[model samples]
Target: MDKSNFRFDDKVVLVTGSAGGIGKTIATAFGKAGARVAICDINRVAAETCLKELRESGIEAMYFAVDLSKKGEPQRMVSDVVDAFGKLDILINNARAGERLELLEDTEENWDITMSVGLKASYFATQKAIPIMDSQGGGNIVNISSVSAHVISSGSAAYHVSKSGLSQLTKYLAVHAGPKNIRVNSVSPGLIVQDEHRNRFKSSDNVNYRTRAEQCHPLKRVGYSQEVADAALFLCSKAASFITGQEIIVDGGLIIQDQWALLSNKTHTTDNI
Candidate 1:
């Protein structure tokens, strides 16, 4: 396939949560694709670091610090991207509340903040971005959902609920906006690992948590940040122009597999007899 098919030359992309981890990787991918990217995160320093990396690689990039949990912050984020680049072409909603490990003990405050930051931010950001897209004739949105949204996990109930809400929001926006040529979609990742995530999940050591997590994946490994970013870049580019309201799963086949390992049982023929 021609690499040009994936090129996003001159397009202005707004990517939220793009300081480090999955968000940073997605920003870099868009930059490499030739899109002018805005790296927005609550951490300005980290966002700027990502922007520097992109610039060093000869990509047009900028950085912004905005808290999505605040009202109007999303709109301002969109506005900053538009103001910098003159038009908005792609929107990647990649920010989420920190992973909640407790199922029942997670507070309602935590849940509300998660929704406000993740699901609510996407909605308001879209609200502010759609008009710009319409004025420019069309665009796309990629919501960063998680596989936990579809599959149940014993952990992080609030995070799971927020992602599920965002996933449905992806569909609703797609339905209403498709006629206007703005495409909306979700990319759900499972067990994506980066240095930061690895450190966060590390436990005192019979075996590293990563190895354990990797074993659970059908592919026998967790995915990289770049892998998820690649999926995001494709959905945002012309290559996926015909795609909308789709939930692209990048879970290393874990989503499809019934079990990660074959179960073994010992049976004694003499005992059975």
Candidate 2:
């Protein structure tokens, strides 16, 4: 693994929902890799803060505040980034409406919010970026999907369905966009703890969610935002030049386990072999 392989010099990257959490980390990671990053989020304040931090770290960055859930906002966002940066080399569709509701209990507004930001926005943004990328020779896109798409949870109906659609969208775009030299793919993360939630999830309480989550993973631990970012960087780099329309699952090996075996092996240990 040559360290120079990850270098993204002269590239311009736009990351959606990059105010805080995983999106912020991904934006920063790209900046560190020598890419000029555009941090876009609905929250103006947080986005500004993130922009300051990136500039302070000597990473060339700018900020764009727009709600992707609104009509035409995604297209406008892509246009805005290109306007500022001259060209768009990479697009990371990391924004999503975080709502938790079951199908029976869900409202139309809630469902629409989730679908709008998670799936629709990504689609439109890519639509806008495709032509620009084709004109510039080529580009890359990484949809920030979730493991929820494959494994369902009780109260995450909209989230699951939206992610499922995103994965399918990735495939659809890959086939159509490939002829233009633009690559599209997705990274589905599982049980990732963002910076703000790390302290709370790490608490050593009687009912420990982290401990329980660790058992479900073969790696015996939950994942961090940086680990997921690394996977994304790889897919966008020349290392994955021949890859497209694929998904790299960063789930600590959770989705691959046999349900029956996991149930039987309740007691878990992480001793170094």
Candidate 3:
């Protein structure tokens, strides 16, 4: 397909949690596609590094260091992006924070932190960006969700709940924003291991972690941040102009396999019966 269909020549895109990992990859993709990118994250140093990389690549980019977990911060971040870029064309809510705690073990503070950044931030950011987008006649919003929303994972109760809420929030916002020419959607990723994660598991004990993880997926490999970024870009591009209120799952078909199928090393043949 032609790459121009995905180009964002004069558009302004705001991506939260873009200091590193999938968020940074999304911002980088947008910057490469000609969009004026805004990188938002709690980590000032990492955000600055991403900002420098984008600028060095001849992409118009800025960085915002804000705690999305705090009330009013999401709105303030939107305001800052608009002030810097003159307009907001696309908003990617990709920042999230979570604690490793089961349902009974989860603390109120941890739950609040998870929901604040994962769900509440997306809601308020969309609320603040609506008017700006409406003024421009239209815009796009892509919430970064996770497979945890649909499939349960051990010790991730709060994170899963927040992601589920985010998915539903996408649908809700799409319904309200459709008439205003604004599109809302979500991209759910599974088992994406980025550079940081690789570093964390570099020891001999976990040297084969990636390989083992790949075996869980039908594709026989784990996903990359760029793959998720591509999905986000497509959802916001002209190619998906008619698409809204939906979710694109970028999981290498991990969620679709049956338990037995995932466990088996060999393919089954009906003729064997």
Best TM-score among the predictions, by candidate number: 2
Cα lDDT of model 1 by residue, 1-273, tens digit = 667879999899888988888988888888888888888889977777777788999988888789999999999989987887899999999987655769758777787778888899999999899888988899999999999888987777878888899889999999988888999999999988764666565655636766767766767778888889889888877788799999999998776664422343332223545
Q: What are the TM-scores, per candidate, against the unseen true structure?
A: 0.89, 0.95, 0.93
**Model 2, TM vs. native:** 0.95
Clashing pairs in 2: none
Clashing pairs in 3: none
Our model 2 lands, by Cα RMSD against the true structure, at 1.8
Cα lDDT tens digits, model 2, 136-170, are 99999999999988998777688899999999999
Would you list the rank order by TM-score, best first?
Answer: 2, 3, 1
Candidate 2 worst ten-residue window by lDDT? 264-273
Give per-residue lDDT, candidate 2, residue 19: 95
Q: After superposing candidate 3 on the true structure, give the runs of residues whose Cα lies further than 4 Å from its correct spot.
A: 196-205, 263-273
Q: Tens digit of lDDT per residue, candidate 3, span 1-273?
A: 877889999999999999999999999999999999999999999888888888999999988889999999999999999998899999999999978798788898999899999999999999999999999999999999999999987876889999999999999999999999999999999989775676665567775876677767877778889999999999999999999999999999888877775457553334434
lDDT of 1: 0.85
Ranking by lDDT: 2, 3, 1
